[model samples]
Target: MSQAAADTMDNTHAAEHGGHHGEHHVLPYTVYFAVYGSLLVLTGITVLVSFAGLGKWSIPVAMAVAVVKASLVVGYFMHLKYDDRLNSLILVVTLLFILIFFAMTFSDMRTRGMIDPVEDNMVLRNEQAAEKAAAAEASGESSEKGEEAHHEGAAEH
Candidate 1:
């Protein structure tokens, strides 16, 4: 084998194995600081929003901010931005499945009460109490007396 041919084979082998001798990308200190600053700002926003009395909207808003922060960290700090496209695609697909799972779980939880006989019974009890109050008012009777009589009847059992 010729010396030049051997050298060419070595180069080809190195290239095939993913040449680590190639130039690497290095992020500047400013970039790191910017990402850190952005994360801090998002944390502050999360705290502020918690105190803003958003009620039911707070959890979703905070989760959204957290997702943005996580993306920034993964893309820049974790070097996924400079990584192979396949890895990025895998991450996206994994996130999509996780989101779908959460959606399905939440849907199941939200609909559980609708199918529960205990919940239906509670609703029926509230309606019956309201009707009883209306009937008592029409008969010029106090609800307190009705409640007392009901309690006494219950105590006999």
Candidate 2:
């Protein structure tokens, strides 16, 4: 093999050579610049997002942007793009577990209104009490009615 071929082999070999081998692989300056540039751009985008009035959609947009930024860091800075299949499998499993957990949690939360009877009952009770209070006040029947009724009942008994 020519010197260029040998150099390329050495670079590729350094990745798989699992030992105290003196052979080292160095990243080019451009890679560093590219990673850092992406990071800066991500920061700028996050800042810009904070300034926008996206209403309820802002949270989803921010989360999507954050996931993209995390993927970039994992693929580039962590060198997962060049890593083995086992590493990717591990990452996929972790993400799957996270998804499952969040899915279950949200499902449970969505069904909470149906599962727990107290929330609707409490709201209905509050509305009924408010209506009754408003009706009583409108009819000029103040709290003294209860007292007067009790007094009249005691006198009759």
Candidate 3:
């Protein structure tokens, strides 16, 4: 083949196959509007939840709504839905690690009192005793200096 024909063929191949290599813009105008609308609705729900005074449920509800909104933004606006499989896998793995970390933290919190309840109290008492000792030392040093001053005054008289 001529060099010109080869160049044209290469360009055509790139045009066809390059979609997967970069961010693919797939959704149209109406889809973008819908995504934005859903995001706004989620925001409103979060705000309403904040006002509802459900106590503990408030945080869970707000968090759930926020997660949904984040998923929408990630899958649509950020083009994660059209992203490469490796990128999707990385996101999933990252989320899994975060969940594992949270799970471990909660596990520790749940079992904290079971191991030895005295440890916590001992820590508090030790802190209090250290403070008391420091205060007493300061007061004793001041009183000794005052007495020494009195003795010097008596000697001068």
Q: Which candidate number has the best lDDT? A: 1
Superposed Cα deviation of residue 123, candidate 2 (Å): 13
- Kindly state the number of residue pairs that clash in model 3: 0
Q: What are the models' TM-scores?
A: 0.58, 0.58, 0.59
Please list the residue runs of candidate 2 whose C-alpha ends up more than 4 Å from where it truly belongs after superposition: 1-25, 116-157
All models: lDDT?
0.77, 0.72, 0.74
lDDT rank order: 1, 3, 2
lDDT, candidate 3, 1-157, per-residue tens: 2553454354445445655465344456665787899999889989988998999898888899999999999977886665565678899999999999999999988866555365555455677877976786777777776668669989999
Best by TM-score: 3
The count of residue-pair clashes in candidate 1 stands at 0
Error of 3 at 76 (Å): 0.2
Taking all chains together, the TM-score of candidate 3 against the true structure is 0.59
